[model samples]
Target: MDVATVKKKVIVVMGATGAGKSRLALSLASHFPAVEIINADSMQVYRGLDVLTNKITPAESQGVPNHLLGNIDPSVEFTCKDFRDLAIPIIDDVLSRNRLPIIVGGTNYYIQALVSPYLADDVVEDMAEDSRISRLTDVDLNDINSASAFKLLNEIDPIAANRIHPNDQRKIQHYLSLYSTSGILPSTLFLGDTSRKWGRADNFRYNCCFIWVDAALPLLDRYVNDRVDSMIAAGLLNEVFDIYKPKSDYTRGLKQAIGVREFDEFFRAYFAADSSWVNSLTNDQVSSDDANMFTKPKLSGILNSHDSNTLRALLIEAIDKFKANTRKLLRRQRRRLNRLKSDFGWKMQYIDATKAFQDESDNSWSVWVVEPCVKIVRSFLLEQPGFLSSTGAPYNVLHLTSKDLCTQYVCEACGNRVLRGAHEWEQHRRGRVHKKRASRLNKCQRTFSVDQQAAKSADGELNSTFCNSP
Candidate 1:
């Protein structure tokens, strides 16, 4: 039988960056007899720099076979298509040996493309060919800046734009080019169930269970802060220094990794005796009038005449920026997980990884995490395809997403403050301050997550900010 016709079901463990995805993936491997894990995290695929990528140590893998972890050379550009193209055969091979496949990570885009193999087929191929030219012409994200780019795309294709991150310039450009070339709304093409789009294939083969290991914002925020601190203590700076101590620039793929780029500007300033390196950034001279059109975060600088204490303060600011940006990344990933269920119709079950992580000392891993997930997997194995609830009623994304009562809007676009409730957020969304920021999100911010803790509203416009002018 073709792999698509095979009844082999795979498990996907997805969540924000610090939500214990690797820990839970390992636990599931111990619970199930023949389970292998494939890394779905975009950063972890690159070889070396374990601390920055938060790579799983050998001790943590517990002898469960894991594929695609720290395997790629960092110099090569790795895309979602690269991940999907490489992962499909390995998944089939593992299933052929009667081993269960567990895909785990924070990179939902990688998981989305892997699950929907053809999702990246045209967009990515076109990008590779037009990468530089498109960087200059209409889809040239570098010329437009991400915020204006996001707003323009949102106005044109809100449905497709909903899935993209505002700061994701490449995807924004790809979608723009895709629409310009095909004249089809990317949201319609990617999210629609028609054969003309990318969705559950008519030849849909795999029995898949997507488990979202999530936590409350307070708990998750604490977890992210602590994790960043731990990574730094465990030698993240050393890993960075090994590469940048020799002065490697962004042309190398490793620099694109989150933990590194956040510190890139600061490192250049610290190492150089003069501000000569700033020239490298300004090499592409546009007309002075056009310079203000770009909205990337201004690389703040410490005064050259300032004392050592001032430079130390600048370093501290850089560290804070890294931690803050990491949280924003997790928040974006959380939104993507919800979109997987809401937009693409993926049946994602929720598990409170915080509870599981806290309950480990009580030896409740099997009880809280492994057993619950396995029970669902066993149902699929028994040909109990999960199209409806036990009562034979079809389910909606609202049913899976709406239990938490502490809903609030996190407007990174506004000022990174959590709006007290849905009404306050709706007001803020319509407020002039938010509308201005929403159009050109500062580098520190991406899109706003209004009513982040609540279920989707009836109109399916939960994330909309005011697009109309006053």
Candidate 2:
């Protein structure tokens, strides 16, 4: 197929965390007339997870339509295969309307699937044959352990095993299944001469462009730290706690996400009160002089005190690690880009949107401001298009304060909201309500222990060590 026959081409914006994927995507959508954004990130698909996932705000979208984002229930699973099925129709619809389709996200696998020729219709059809694959319609592959999937793949296709990375479980499984069913190796199929067929009515080709945003590691680390602080100020902890109710897996993906996971650790330490208990026990056994030996406060108070300096330090450390991981991730992305360029001769560009924005702004300054949640509530009023006064003027907008958005409350054992007051709030903290909930949650976490968690934790520790060491 010729370039013109491709009809509507797609531009994929991809990179790692703090690379400004969402900002760049929004900028591209705004600048490029008739370009629609299709969210290629797996975590951003969940609703009520705006801050943690760095989801594009409604204002950023500017009424420019977006697809496959904030639509899925967090409890349900979402996989690459599931994304492929959902995205195909959206892409077709965009092309049919003669609009440019831009797949933008930090999710490498998702963007790779869309931009690479690997997701041709026949491959998708072949994948649909397995019933195990059918069960993963709602699961997010980002939540799965790469090693587990790779192990399963190795059992099916040892030849494919030599070619696939143990950390790339998604591709390994796909190829293993393909080889097992068709008796044809995926590598051979990929290099074959048969043109991909997308049915008679939907026979279309695509020319793709890829753009990578580059940044210095230190700057990226600072950005992640600042972003995490912003999320906390935006009430991300309360939001996660609200969704992390009994037996609810909504926080599953969020728990795996960087900022969210750190916050989860903080929350776990805060509610358990185990640290406090341990401290009390130790203090009771120690002599008055000996008590001074243990200078550091218990983890419970350290975690829940909301001390600005301590929290900031923790956030910075987490971001530093995140930045190191991002560097490795970018290296992988560069390799993929090189492969794409070599095979398809696609044009690639590297633009630093953060630098561009800084240069464009007259202020030339960055500030962190914590506006009252009430202010957001107030903006909601003025945003309404039709509200007017009797004098034919727009109604004055109401801005909400932090107190209005969050009220203090008391509760008994079993975790229920009670009346609002300083007395009540103190009473709730002193009561057994939160303790019971924490105990139950601890039990639940142990009960639903997936092997994936262990693998992820091990990989995380290794990555952290590698990044921290000289």
* lDDT values for all models: 0.67, 0.53
Pull out the clashing pairs in model 2.
77-138, 77-139, 78-138, 78-139, 78-140, 374-400, 374-401, 378-398
**lDDT for each residue of candidate 2 in 1-470, tens digit (9 for 90 to 100):** 57554334566676656666666666555445687889987888877677767787788788888898888776665666567778878998998898778788776656555544454435545544542422333334445456665665556545556454455544555665455444454544433322221111122244444566655555665666676667656755555654443233322444444444444444444434346534754678755344333423333234455667544456445545544554565555555444433323344455544453344352321111112111221232233344221112222222111112124343434444444334335544665767777678767777668656888899999999999998
lDDT of 2: 0.53
In candidate 2 the C-alpha lDDT for residue 446 amounts to 79
- TM-scores for the candidates: 0.66, 0.53
Please provide, for model 1 over 63-153, each residue's C-alpha lDDT reduced to its tens digit, 9 standing for 90 to 100. Answer: 8888999999988768787888899899999988988999998887787677663564555444454343222235544456667878888
Candidate 2 residues lying further than 4 Å off, grouped into runs, are: 1-6, 29-33, 116-121, 124-152, 169-204, 243-256, 260-267, 274-335, 342-344, 352-470
Error of 1 at 281 (Å): 22
The lDDT leader among the candidates is 1
